[model samples]
Target: MSTYLTILGFNSAIPTVKSAPTAQFLEMEERCFLIDCGEGTQVQLRKAKAKFSKINHIFISHLHGDHVFGLPGLISSFRLLGRETPLNVYGPKGIKAMMEAIFKYTETYQGFEVIFHELSSKNSEKIFEDNRVEVYTIPLDHRIYCNGYLFKEKPKERHLNMKEISKYPEIEICDYHNLKRGKDFILKDGYVLKNEVLTTAAEPPVSYAFCSDTRYLESIVPIIKNVDLLYHEATFLHDLKEMAEYTGHTTALEAAKIARKAKAKKLILGHFSNRYADYQVFLNEACEIFPETYLPQQLEPVKI
Candidate 1:
């Protein structure tokens, strides 16, 4: 299964001509998920070549405008596109009411079903799961109730060794699934062949964590530890550390420290404040602490 992340918008509360707001597209095993529907998210999605109709789930981190201002427009666009599939949206408690108010005033009747899952947990909890992936909420420290999302690929079945299986003509193709499931194969003569001889171990599962618009909270380190890719908010440079804390945001250095403590494989900095024109400074500061830090460009896919 292929897994990757596409950054749609990365700016903080303010939107600029060069950048939008906080939105990301997570593609795992061909299923698409929208992390945050910031302003111009639909436009960014198109720019990124992400099919809008393919995204069935949208996860909002908080009730802030920069994070969810684009939702009504996105959902309205989906209706215009003749989307009939039920859309599942997960967010904080007031999301449903907010959407309802927008729809009522705009008289936008959704042709498709919109299901809302309200989140209010203060601890890490599994919120969504399917055969391919499982999503958990990472409780974050923000001025308002906030949560990040953790995407983890499910364990895959063992790979069948063709060469080993070819040695036994008696073993039929129907038994391949059993062998992959680590079950022994019984021959016609009642002889048993162990599964270990026929298959090899599957590759380890991959995980991605998305954290943004929150203060430097060490409590989340254990929840996101050892993720393949960690996208944390770096709203300000080290010099503005005090301002970052006051605004419930994190500086680049603080983001790097969290990544290092969690032992993340790679750290991707985002949610930049508009004060800084050049984002290289954020990368430079973060890389000093966590060498495997990255800064994503708009519409570029980062493979995990």
Candidate 2:
């Protein structure tokens, strides 16, 4: 099993010839999570060959059109395809009410159930928790009621060393499972076997943070520290720094600063302004401070 992240759309508010607004698809084990379904998100997913039917959970940062314009359409399509699995949506307040209005006016109905978990507070609270993962809301500064999301993998039990395990075939395989689970086993021969001697610790869990359309606020640094991967908005270049501040957005340099301060392992920058015909300037600006910075184009899949 693997945890991977894919970028479906990277533009903000507007759709350029080469880019579209904020959408990300994350694959964790057998489940998938969709973040910010902007306009044409389903189309982008089709191009990326991501299985839309596998998406049982969706997280929307805010009510902005660029962040959620495609949600209604995707839900409509799910009905057409006759999906029966229940869907869970996590978003800010008014999301549930907003979708209710749409369905009421349009007379749209789904074959499956849809559950919405509204997030209204500013504190970083646990919004979702399950056996495989946990998610929290990262309060963000934006024009509207906006926030970011953090996806953290749950700790897993250790795997036994198969070669070493084969030496004691006479031992019950059930006992070996106990040993791998950090339980000490007492062999029939009066030998005490420690769990550490037979198994190594599991690999550290990975995490991803998605900060879309937020201003340059360093307050979120502590919360996102040491994340395996971070996707922050870089909607403008240094030349338009003043405009960025006025519009509550960040430049490439500012995004890099947050990554550096947080000590993140890697930074992926996107949500570029419409003025930029080429994204090389944003790339060059961010890489100056954080060497692991990358500029992801539309439909580029970044392994987490």
Candidate 3:
């Protein structure tokens, strides 16, 4: 199975000629999730060629206009598309009311059911989980109540060694399931085969952390430590560090420092402020602290 993340939008507050606000699409285990539906998010999704029908869940980081203005438009479009699948939206308090008001004012009714999951917690907590993946909230420090999501893949089943299993003609196809579950195989001759001998260990689980629209916060380091990939907001360059903190946003240096402290495998910097015409300054500042940092472009999918 492959895990892919497409950068739909990465700019902060304002949309520029090259970027929009904060929106991303994460595809894992054949399931799709949208994070932060900023303005122009639906258009970005279309440009990225994301399967809009497959996105059952959307997670909003905060109530900022740049972060949530596109939700009503997207929901309305879904109605126009005649979608029947229920859409699950997770966000901070007041999201449901805000969305409902828009629908009511516009006299728009969705053809599909819209389920809202309101978040009120101020600590890290598991919000969603299934057999294949789990999602947790990373309490973020911002002017308003905000949260980042951490998506982690569940440990997979061991791969069956076909060559070893082929040696036993007595083994039925159904028996392969048990072998993958780490059960020893018992032959008709009463010979017991160790599970380790018949299967290879599964790949280690992968984790992705999305942190955006927040100030430099160290408290979250423990929760996201050693994450495979971290998408942290770098809203400004180091020269504007004071302005970033004043606006409850993080500078590139601060974001890189957080990644370094957490021992994250890789860092993807985003949420750029449109004021900076040169994005290379952000990359240069971050790379000085965390060499594995990356700057993603819109519509490009980064496979993990």
Candidate 4:
């Protein structure tokens, strides 16, 4: 699979015995990323059997306790594990200071450098990029300066159509690489063979959007449009719309509306407030507007 997302924790505010907080482990294009290191994240990661060393990059949504309380502990664990690779942390402007102060007061020492890419721009911008994947920030409106993240895979190379290529004796094994790269092959007599004739179309790149704690903000529809999967906060029922707005959270209906407007293929609802006893209500409410909506399958790796 090119992309897999495991929900480490999805509870809001108070972490209960059954659930932790808002954190996720995303493996995209062979790159593992930790998103929003909330409390109990490390324990959840262990349960999920994730390779901690593979998580070289982390994306923090905001400074809320439920969103960032586990960051220092996770960093300490990395240090104890003797990790030498520099960790790149992408978050708001004050994240570095906050982490540094906590480490200093708590007497934590790091064996490796932690590169903090402090983000403050309200606009959506690319935060990380490599040969296989690209990540962007989705600025969110919450009580604090929060930002969601978008992970997109780079377009893959086309597959070599052996049956068609076998018809042309001039197409050698050495020409396979160029053909997959969409390059036409020129024969000795100057006759050209189109790459499309010898290669099948590549798998379409997929994208996953994480909309953390936010109000019903429709501005992000354009940014996450046509995403393969979307994980958005659905903290309250529509009956508590005023309270949801006051606390900077989204209702189940609102999250579905956002997913519908963005034309997302699937939607995962998370960050449920403890007030709700039955989680099925969330699924029922959201399914009304977006039938693809689903409650998070915690610890289960969801293919995007």
Candidate 5:
């Protein structure tokens, strides 16, 4: 079965006693992907009951402090926990330099190797791919060179038929593996069994996208279209539309609009501005346009 995505933190530039900045944890297939490690991300992850040791890849959307200020501590914690697995970090330029400076000044020694893959362009394209999933960079309009990430799981193999296997019990059980591989079964008598007779297609893999700290940019619609779950930044309410545009952020309604245009199955709104004491307005505003819209609070994990 496929795993669900979780939200770790969902506040804006200012971290309040009630909420923190942008940070998310995607739990899929026994692996964890940390997206935008904002300040106090470690604490939020612990609160969400996410295993930090399971995180092998970290994706940073931008160089803004609100997006990636917890790198030093997170890396240090890994070393302290005696982690030997290599960590692959994908982010925009300047991240490598920032990490290097942190390690050099703090004299922190890591038990694992840290690999940095920096993104340097605005074009929407694949940044990483493996047997498990593929990640794409979604260009956005921000004050800095920012990009979102889209994660799509690889398709599963076909299921096998146990009833058909019962008749061929005398035959090698290894042939069952072939059925799962979508191959036809052949008997010693030269008779062939079609794949459709012994197997069925498994469920299709799902996809999720994370878009934070960006303005109302419609160009990203194509990149995030039809995603199973989408988490976009909504730093202000509709009443603060001017503030959102001036600061290169987005309002709750604007985030919902993008989710609706992209035809995403679910929309999670976060990265709220500190000006709002309560998130009721944000929640009400977002759901008004998109009924599936949801507001993620700090350390509150919402299954996708």
Candidate 6:
């Protein structure tokens, strides 16, 4: 199955009537990942009809309130619901202390275990991995310590060609697993059948990169090179690039440039400022450099 990404909120620092702050839901290989828990994320998840219990991992980009203000409330809800599985949260160095302080003031003990994996490395590093997917941190240039995340699906098994396998009656159903694993089949007489003849090549692995609340930095291009889908923050227009640099945010034009340099297949421009009412302006600006650019549709899932 393909990966799907849902944008829960896509506004800038403020939550407007039309949009909220930065938050996203990524589903890869049946695993749920929440990227940034902005305010009202729980409500947004309900609106999206997401499977809340499957969200065992959350990735926070920075300490900004707009990016992380909704975490305490979500955990509290989990506690009330009696979640027994452990939840892993990955973020900057002080994330553990911040969450602990919040929990200390509110409810003391939680029924479920909340594991906080604090990160302080300025360079890119592998932070999460399972049998199906792996995640890496992309060091970002922002006002404070921040990071973007890259999610990549692991290599898949080759497809079984039943038509070819039917030629040999010796190949039983129990041997199909080996064929899908790209292993050759051998008969009792020692005649070997090549794996390429019995199975087709597997599809290329899919990858996604999330770049939130960062200035125009070229260093991240190499880390997210050739990403299947890229979601980068575009908080301003090109005319206000100076202000964007001062505030540690990227303009739509600069975001497109980064996508072009990284050779991303699809680029998504989000985290829009409230001043801009029309999203077409952001689309027009980014499409000039990258044609596959898209705007965020609230709670709508995009297949990657």
TM-score of predicted model 2? Answer: 0.95
Residues 232-276, candidate 2, lDDT per residue (tens digit)?
999998778899889989989999999999999999999998888
lDDT of 1 by residue, 1-304 (tens): 6798999999899899888899999999778999999989999999998978999999999999999999999999999989999999999999999999999999999999999999998999999999889999999999999999999998878999899899999988988888877898888899988888899997778899999879999999999999999999999998998998999999999999999999999999999888888899999999999999999788999889
How far off is residue 238 in model 3, in Å? 2.4
Residue pairs clashing, model 2: none
* Stretches > 4 Å off in candidate 2: none
Clashes of 3: 0
Q: Write the per-residue lDDT of candidate 4 for residues 227-266, one digit (tens) a residue.
A: 9999999999999999999999999999999999999999
Q: Please identify model 1 stretches exceeding 4 Å from their true place.
A: 184-196
Local distance difference test values of all predictions, in order: 0.93, 0.88, 0.93, 0.94, 0.85, 0.94
Indicate whether candidate 1 or candidate 2 has the larger lDDT.
Answer: 1
Query: For residues 1-304, could you state the per-residue lDDT of candidate 3 as single tens digits?
Result: 7899998998888787778888999998888999999989999999999999899999999999999999999999999999999999999999999999999999999888999999999999998899999999999999999999999999889999999989889888999888888999988789999999999998888889999889999998999999999999998888887998899999999999999999999999998887778888889999999999998778999998
- TM per prediction: 0.96, 0.95, 0.96, 0.97, 0.92, 0.97
Error of 1 at 287 (Å): 1.2
- For residue 23, what is the lDDT in candidate 4? 94
lDDT of 6 by residue, 44-73 (tens): 999999989899999999999999999999
Provide the clashing-pair count of each candidate structure.
Answer: 0, 0, 0, 0, 0, 0
Once fitted onto the true fold, the runs of candidate 6 whose alpha carbons sit more than 4 angstroms away are none
The TM-score of candidate 6 is 0.97
True-structure RMSD for candidate 5: 2.0
Comparing 1 and 6 by lDDT, which wins? 6
